[model samples]
Target: MQSWQKVQCGVLLSISIAVMAGCSASSPYRDRAEDYRHAEPSHYELPPIPGQRDQMPIPQGSTQGYTGDEFIAPRPESMQTGVAERPPVELRKDNQGPWLWVNTGPAKVWPALQRFAEEKNLDVVYTNPRSGELMVRADVGGTPAQRFSLRQGVGRQTSEVRIVSMSSGQALPFSEFDRERMMALEQYLLVTQQQQNGRVSLAAQNLDDGDQVRWVDRDGRRLLVLDFAFDRSWGELQNLLSNGFDEDAQRLDDQDRSQGIFYIHYLARAERDSGFWSWLFGSDNADKAKAYRLVLTPSGDMTELHVEDASGQPADIQVEQELLDWIRRQLT
Candidate 1:
């Protein structure tokens, strides 16, 4: 009976093993796991989102691509050459003196001022177009007749007429009378008759349009060259920042005239957007404004201006050019 029991146990154990092997061979989870590991996406394509487009393929040898990148570059330097449109004629004053900035060259300004003196019935004491100076005797309010000086050809195709009141050979302060005289001349120059007259003064032809502010390229880097002493250059730039440019106000963050560094916040007109959405959101211009350092170095009598970042590090070439151009336009 014991032998029969052992044979029966062996048969039962073999049958149990066969049943377990059959269950393992037909297991659903075992086969499904392999399919899950090797699964791929469906063949159908989804519609693209509105206002979205696929990025272009990168160039073969390019190490990086800017497409689809949020980075906006500085406006490229204007390649269009030739004289830019002259700034509108305006009246400017500073510690030096009040002067009328005429947009035309000395040739036109000299003749126009001569006509002004004649029309006003003012006594002309001296006239030297070559030196860009004209002295006229005019009464200032109740004061005696003072010597008014009109200087032409101050900058590039520009003129400055300054009235100097000399009492006992001592220069007096410019009064409202002087300003009225300048305003009259400014209006005279703007008239279509005067501008279309084409009467170029032969004597003033020799008057040097003392181009005090200009651009120069040195060692492959562009610079704004001010043909003046360091002290004078500093004063000129300071006056510009103080007076501000056209519609945009120039902000002078910090300045060290002795060290020849001016830290300023600058915004280029090209970077500005006039769209309705841009104005409503105030997003475009706020991000475009940047701070830059203007470094001045004396080169003989001339002062050289170079643009750098706010930290004094070299700025991007395009940004430097734009800043320099802005300075040149204002100073000139």
Candidate 2:
């Protein structure tokens, strides 16, 4: 009877221990937390230090000053938000005919034209990506059928798109309807986004007839050769001279279309020599003004531009080169 009583007492002690453990687990840190009631409320929310019970104090001059303030992250420079700029598209006409001048390669324009045809519900009768040409018949909805000839431009990364009405296998003259269609294409190109694939068609690139301008050396002198005829070259040069050429501003002095010569005065930015007294006393660097003559010579199909001094003699080598380079840039 004594041993059984001892066993019962041991079981009772185990139960009491378990009850106390459960009560402490329910509010493990209640007593310790009440001891620190006077401390700041934020102190209790800080991350505890590794192997340490105490939390670290907030550093002086920290972001704590921005408490209760709304923050906005800045946008990165590479991440553009607004509508991006589209490729350049222009409808141009010359003595040849009306054509669209798009500042892009034929490869890109080929796909764009296909997409346009699909969107307009036009029937693509034929497509020759090698020749950079697409023959589409837009006769649907009582619209007159037309054919277009797309070709690579003489300049790099440019295309010349031409259109005409077709009837009985004969192409008609460019009409108002053709112009309207061309304008729509131009607008489409202007607004639509283009990819930067840097694609080039070998055959289409070969279709580029020739360069508009070229530089050649003949008889110990450099010449700016234009692939255009003399009349066209003259008209182009006149237009360029009428407008300004560069930031320094080259002005026309005299011109004689009969003689195919233009005299222009060029002033470097340093030679401008503008000052408070310049208007009254003239510029001290007025003597630095350089005058050059642009002489056009017809060579079969090409026109050559020869730079000469003010007196009509051979221009200084360095000055002639610089003038030739500037004129080439303007022409191209």
Candidate 3:
């Protein structure tokens, strides 16, 4: 009976302790909160420090100065807010490569670039990261002043522009791409120049026929090359080469010493018609600038005949066979 009474007493004591703890937590005051009733804010709210059991001292008057902010605890860093800048690379990356990267400002890069220009035969007039003047070497000799510029892209991109002045008073800007294109364009210029030179060289051979004409590609045997100009008559050319030339030369010599022209006749069919030979071989001053030639070749005999001019002069030329052989030797 005694133990049961003690156990009942113990149980009641535990209940009493719990109820007292709950009451204390629920109460808005610890002791004598009524004494500070004068200090109570008319529009009271809890401070950041929590329950506000502690009142911060304030001036006796001026309720407006005592904002709720006055009693708050210091703010945590995460709570602070404002615009923030992007972090520096040094701060962002834990470890950088061994060598430090410094900007080596545009001023420093200029000298090295200047040295580079000099070696390239370009004069370093003045350079900045932007625009400047430079002297560039010319093909003939010496150097001439030129314009230069540097351009940058949105990112850290860079480019160079060079302007060259030719003897003609115009400036041409050369980009990186222009230099590459010139390699192919220059080849075209070379080929055209060579063709013009070849046509000039072939000019001498145009007036004669093969066998009697100059054979540039000939071997030991005599050869002639003939060209028919689009404007001239091919029949006249044929007759002149066949027998008209020798006949005209002889006729002119026999006619008279006083008359400049002499005529000759080849009695090809025996019609006594020298007029046919004369008509084809004789020159009319209207076509004086025009004439056709033929080259006739036999190893032992080569005789080519050029026609007479409108002045009645004899058609006379002595083209040798050995000249053909000599030209052929050169080709090989």
**How would you encode candidate 3's per-residue C-alpha lDDT over 69-129 as one tens digit per residue?**
5443322322211113211111000111111111122222233334446655554545444
lDDT of every model, 2 decimals: 0.68, 0.69, 0.32
TM-score, candidate 3, is: 0.19
Give per-residue lDDT, candidate 1, residue 130: 79
RMSD after CA superposition, every candidate: 24.1, 17.8, 42.5
Name the regions of candidate 1 deviating beyond 4 angstroms: 1-88, 138-155, 192-195, 210-212, 217-221, 229-262, 266-285, 295-301, 329-332
lDDT of 3 at 283: 33
TM-score per candidate, in order? Answer: 0.58, 0.53, 0.19
Residue 178 deviation, candidate 2, in Å? 1.9
Candidate 2 lDDT? 0.69
Which candidate ranks first by TM-score, i.e. highest? 1
Deviation in Å, model 3, residue 20 alpha carbon: 38
lDDT of 2 at 39: 71
Model 3, residue 329: what's the lDDT? 28
**Which is the winner by TM-score between candidate 1 and candidate 2?**
1
Residue range 1-332, candidate 1, lDDT tens digits: 99999999999999999999999998886666568778888798899788886588665773222345466675554453223444546666656666666666777677877887788788788888877666655455555355544444335766666667666667777777667766776677678234477888888877544667887777667888887778657766765665553222236777886798887776664566655786686554545668888899999988889988877778766567666876786666
